[model samples]
Target: MRPFLLLLSLAFSGLLAAAEVTLTNGEWPPYLGQQLPHYGVASRIVAEAFALEGVEVHWEFYPWARALQMAERGQRVGTAVWTHSPEREQRFFISEPVVESAYHFFHRKDRAFDWQRLDDLRGLRICGTLGYNYGEPFQQAERDKRLQVRRLPSDELCFRQLLAGRIDVFPMDKVVGFAMLHEHFSAADRAQLSVHPRALRSDPLHLLLSREVPGNAELMVRFNHGLAQLRDSGKVAQYLLDAQQPLSLAP
Candidate 1:
């Protein structure tokens, strides 16, 4: 083979290799789920973003904790739709924000409460998802014993406990909480529940690439560029709107 032809073939192979990426995520409805259309909104946005760069994505769904572990160990290129944290920032190369989620406290309609600060949570038994990161303030309060928290395996169980008065309240993403209510409860049951009007916090979710992965920094750059293109083209906004459509809700 001619020397120039050999070089050209190797370059083509490298391009093909760089065009594929594998990612992991858990079932978080309206954001990501295997049964969802386009695998939910954030999934679609990530897909489109990579498509802009001629890259293809292969996604695997696992338990949230397991997925994060796999990504951290470099078993997958990255995981998507993760809330930012100082620990994650130190351990991974995080892409630009992919979605914003409003966290709110939910309780039975008959037991409504309001709070302007974390202090109000004192003496309350709050339910939390076992592997979720609900921001630093909430974690700190739990760690410092300022509030009592019961970690549950799933959101459905937490909602059941809340209704049965076993838990005072539970925090969840506004959309995700509503979707879970609609999925697991009767119309009457749903009507008996309410989310606090005040959001605890609004945090941007990002794709976190494991620092253990080779060339992860370059991959982050590619992802950010593609994400920026998606935003500038108005596709990200459209994806957000579509994600909230009733038809997209999980069963």
Candidate 2:
């Protein structure tokens, strides 16, 4: 390698490091949130992936629905950590999964509860969070009058209802649920909650770049490339571990 060639490569890397991008985000604790370390796990992954491509990420936090809308309307570049659906696929260029997560029903330990299927939830009061899809099977059951679910504004409210005996069960991402409880509840309050053993559903979350934003198609390509590198190096798993640690903080 010639000295000139090495210098050119170094110069190019510097230029890439100077590039920046902004995206919309929302609260989904221990994963994506404004308050957590590195703004939570998923946020750190998304930021690091872009940084690998020399693109800095500036996040605009909002309600989950508004985050989607701002990105869908191209008011921002895109949004992070959304599950794919046919409607979303039509409007956005989806990146490879940033993280895989599963949801489980959280209940009060005082109340005996067990379920092999959604049908088992027949007479129980189920709490649903707004702007979330519990998947088609759960939805269909709710529509058919087999499951009773009441929608709420956030996971915090759902948990509050559960403690108050206003709701029998609430489905939440396993990590997010525990993370929220750990952050906001007392030891006694935490003791009162227990997650069901069976998972409700699992989904691979993604970064969505709206078609309305020019140059985003190519940006998606660059992002996926960076994400592949991140995964291959095993930092994705390490980041998740770090994000969950008791005193996880920005390094």
For model 2, how does the per-residue alpha-carbon lDDT over 100-153 read when each residue is reduced to its tens digit? 989999999899999998779999999998767898999899879888989998
Which stretches in model 2 have alpha-carbon errors above 4 Å? 1-18, 245-251
Report the lDDT tens digits of candidate 1 across residue range 1-251.
69999999999986865678899987988889999888889999988888887789999999888999999999999999888888998889998999999999988778868888999989888999887777789999999989899999988999899989998889999888877777778777777777788888898999999999998898888889999999999989988877666631233
Q: Cα deviation in Å at residue 21, candidate 1?
A: 1.0
Q: What CA RMSD would you report for each candidate?
A: 3.7, 4.0
Model 1: how far residue 27 lies from native, Å:
1.0
TM-score of each: 0.85, 0.88
TM-score of 1: 0.85
Flag clash pairs in model 1. none
